[model samples]
Target: MTYLASPSTLFGRLINRTQYADLPWSNILAINFLRGRLNRLSANLPNLIEELSDENLQSAWKVLQPLYYDLYMLRAIQESKQIVQPGETLTREEALRLLHFP
Candidate 1:
């Protein structure tokens, strides 16, 4: 049987193998790729949802949400770090809304 680690574990392993200085750009590239994939999926979602039973859709969402949330947080943090000016900082409400901080 194959055992899979959590998404964060897998992501950490990938990053640790790369040069730290390359992380910001590499992460941005990954984010863009994921965004494109998500956009394509979203465009198809209505048809897909029409065919899916509610139980099946819920099951798929349960599996997908964590991976998507992790990638989102990674993108947010990376972009926040890359912000160069005080004016570029996210507003308190915007940061809260985007990051879903507790």
Candidate 2:
């Protein structure tokens, strides 16, 4: 007998659709860092959509991990009283707090 995987699990569909090459190198590194951390935490962890729905996992990611600037950019843009450049750099501690993981 032969079996076929579900459409969701199809080999071609597993290719990452995001154009990582179009992102800045810093953003790419940040994404890779988060992916590595999550994989190290659980080899069989579900895809991002499912994982994000788990409150405990979300809390763990928020409170127990280092922050990445890419993840903090949105809020900084929304709340900042001054215009900040996308390429601006913050001190490590400041960046961590801005990302809300410090």
Candidate 3:
């Protein structure tokens, strides 16, 4: 428990537990909802970025920063197996790790 007391602890927790993390079907549905939005955001990012002139890069940075981080973290999670046939519920650390962080 002490290990997860801080934000940095949660960051470290994600790397180890992201693999094969299980999720309930309802949660899966919700994740799918958000994932569609995320996909749209990700797809637009490059074009939006390309339209920016050098002077506007500062403003673009704000959007790109969060987008980049989410992509990395999401990729980490997806490296795990998705939708196991037996449908295991997520374990303690993984459950905490997924919902608690951004």
| Candidate number of the best lDDT | 1
- What is the TM-score of candidate 1? 0.40
Error of 3 at 71 (Å): 9.2
Candidate number with the higher TM-score (1 or 3): 1
**What TM-score do all the candidates reach, one by one?**
0.40, 0.25, 0.33
RMSDs, each prediction? 12.7, 15.1, 16.2
lDDT of 1: 0.65
Q: Backbone clashes in each candidate structure, one number apiece?
A: 0, 0, 0
Local accuracy by lDDT, each model: 0.65, 0.52, 0.57
lDDT value, residue 66 of candidate 1: 89
Query: For model 1, how does the per-residue alpha-carbon lDDT over 1-102 read when each residue is reduced to its tens digit?
Result: 112334334344333324566568768678656666655665676787779988998898799778777876877777677876677667988988988764
Clashing pairs in 2: none
Best prediction by TM-score: 1
Ten contiguous residues minimizing lDDT sum, candidate 2: 1-10
